[model samples]
Target: MSGSFYKVECPDCENEQVVFGKASTEVACAVCGTTLARPTGGNADIEGDVLETVEAR
Candidate 1:
């Protein structure tokens, strides 16, 4: 089975970028020049909501 799509937020600029495929390292931000951990970044609002749902339950 394949791992679920995961998101990663930029720690520096708080920018978001989607990771459409498998795991990767050193994915750069499309807007900024920051080297992010993962390329899949859920927008701040979406990120928050997902977290909320998990926490609520």
Candidate 2:
């Protein structure tokens, strides 16, 4: 599947961030420095609360 953007809420500080669905690197929360997603072979492993899936415009 193609990569997409997702709005994620940090579990630690409730900070929101947009992250790539298929990110090849670790994604961290900008406010709290918490890990949000990890790189897998396919889709990224999401660790934060997913708010929504953003559509590419």
Candidate 3:
């Protein structure tokens, strides 16, 4: 079983970035440096709007 990916939209900058579903560390927006996701030892806590969920291929 593998984790998935997500396309998250930054609320402040509206920058779209690919984030790991089970990210071990904090994920920030590339353009605005805003916190996008936080690690919880499982699926990350997505802060911004989750545009899509990308399955592992």
Candidate 4:
């Protein structure tokens, strides 16, 4: 699957961040340093509140 961006809100600190859908590495919240997403080969395993799916232009 193609990579995409997603808007996610940290459950711990409620900080919002943009993350890669198929991230090859772990993604963390910038504000609180909370673990947000983990790489899972295809789509990343998200651990935050998914605000929306970002559309590529």
TM-score per candidate: 0.41, 0.90, 0.89, 0.88
- lDDT of model 3, residue 20: 89
lDDT for 12 (candidate 2): 98
Q: Residue 37's C-alpha lDDT in candidate 3?
A: 96
Local lDDT at 26 for model 2: 96
Q: What are the per-residue Cα lDDT tens digits for candidate 1 across 1-57?
A: 243433545566666555333334545667776654443433222221111121110
List model 3 lDDT by residue over 6-50, tens digit each. 899999999999998889999989898999999999889999998
> How does candidate 2 fare on TM-score?
0.90
Q: Which pairs in model 1 have colliding backbones? A: 8-40
Mind sharing the TM-score for model 4? 0.88
Task: State the C-alpha lDDT per candidate.
Answer: 0.41, 0.91, 0.91, 0.89
**Residue by residue across 1-57, what tens digits does model 2's lDDT show?**
567899999999999999999889999899979999999988899999899988653
What tens-digit string does per-residue lDDT give for candidate 4 at 1-57? Answer: 567789999999999899988889999899988999999877889999889988653
Model 1 Cα displacement at 12 (Å)? 1.2
